[model samples]
Target: MTDEELAISVSGLRKSYRDNQAVAGVDLAVRRGEVFALLGPNGAGKTTTVEILEGFRQRDGGDVSVLGVDPAKAGADWRKRIGIVLQGTGEFDELKVGEVVRHFARFYPNASDPAEVIERVGLSDKANSRTHTLSGGQKRRLDVALGIVNRPELLFLDEPTTGFDPAARREFWDLIRQLSHQGTTILLTTHYLDEAEALADRVGVINRGAMVAVSTPAELGGRHQATARVGWREDGQARFEQTDHPTDAVRRLSERFGGEVPELTVTRPTLEDIYLEMLGEKEEQQ
Candidate 1:
């Protein structure tokens, strides 16, 4: 896609602290209206790159654009076009949920209604509760309510569901999908491979300050092309064969058995499997 169509664009992105390079010659592009997930282990420069994109930190070198404006040079008007939910829960313990949402709604000229935003994030019932009384997952919902209350064209989520239970995490994923369906471009950073698989249109992996790969969850690290494992019970033993075409292998196995292959199962490398392999290789090269 063209630069105009990208919500974020970075080329030769670099940053350093004293003698250590936290980010090194990284390149990335996130398309408008698409959910993009950035994956990396701790200290892999994911935070640094995202901070530069959010204009919260300055990069030592590289060209960066977010929402068609250079974030490093952005002003208040530019800021209104994007929203961010940081790793920490931005809370006012003394305020009610509705009151807090209303306060933040005033920051943007085109902000959505406080009540509606709260409801959209599934917080309507807790609107009158004190911030300090909410659960961990509720705090996260409140954070998202504030983030999208501005009706931002782009939203940044940093470990959005870190402390959420499984069910709450799934609910948050649905909310993310609703936002994307309404034309919001989302940039998400998460350690959960399943989260990326469920929410991202495309996922990018960064290792040791460089982008290792970028593709759909199923295709990352050539996962789609990777060999498949076909397993079955044979002659009182469990046996399996690794091949590119599992169907062909299964067909031969069935023919050999002259009937249904016993306990047949076909498996391919999962997203986590491919992700770990990428990180392992990157570490070895260093």
Candidate 2:
């Protein structure tokens, strides 16, 4: 894609704190109108890299552009074009949900209607409730509401569903898809592999302060080429083998059992499995 087509671009990015290097010669690009998921282990420079992109921290070296402007030198107008939902919830104990959303809506020039934003995030029922009285998942919805209240071109979501239950998480996923469908570019950081698999057009994995790999969820770490595990019960004991052709193995097992294979199953590596392998966590096992 052309430079003008990208919402964010980083080349040879570097950052360090005292004696520790948080980011080292990293590179990344996020296209406009795309959901890009960034995954990494603890202390893998994810936060530092994001802070630099958000203009909350200065970088030591690199050419970084967000919305065609250098974030290191970004101004108030530039900041207004991007929205961020941090990991922590806001402390608005005395304020109603609608009041809080309306207050934040004032910060941007092209802000959306507070009521509509609330409804979009599935927070319409809590619009009149006190912020402190909302449940954990509701608070997260409010956070998303505030983030989109600006009608931002690019939205940054950091651990957006940390406290959500399974059902709530699915609901939030739908909300994210709705936003993306509305032409909003999103940069998502999450520990949930399933969330990344569901929401991201492409995912980038960072390890040891550097980018290790970037690809579609299905192809990362060669997951599509990886072997599948075929398992079945044999003599009251489970037997398994890794094979590229699991269907043939299953057919063989079915014939041997005269119509059915007891406890027969075939499974492939999940996104998390490939992610861990890419990060070299699986190497420790070897």
Estimated TM-score per prediction?
0.96, 0.96
lDDT of 2 by residue, 222-256 (tens): 99999999998899899998999999888888888
Question: Candidate 2 overall Cα lDDT vs. reference?
Answer: 0.91
- Candidate 1: tens digits of C-alpha lDDT, residues 23-74: 9999999999999999999999999999999999999999999988999899
Question: TM-score for model 2?
Answer: 0.96
Worst lDDT 10-window in candidate 2:
277-286
Q: Would you list the clashing residue pairs of candidate 2? A: none
Each model's lDDT: 0.94, 0.91
Best by lDDT: 1
Q: Can you give the lDDT of residue 136 in candidate 1?
A: 94
lDDT for position 161 in model 2:
89
Question: lDDT of model 1 at residue 131?
Answer: 94
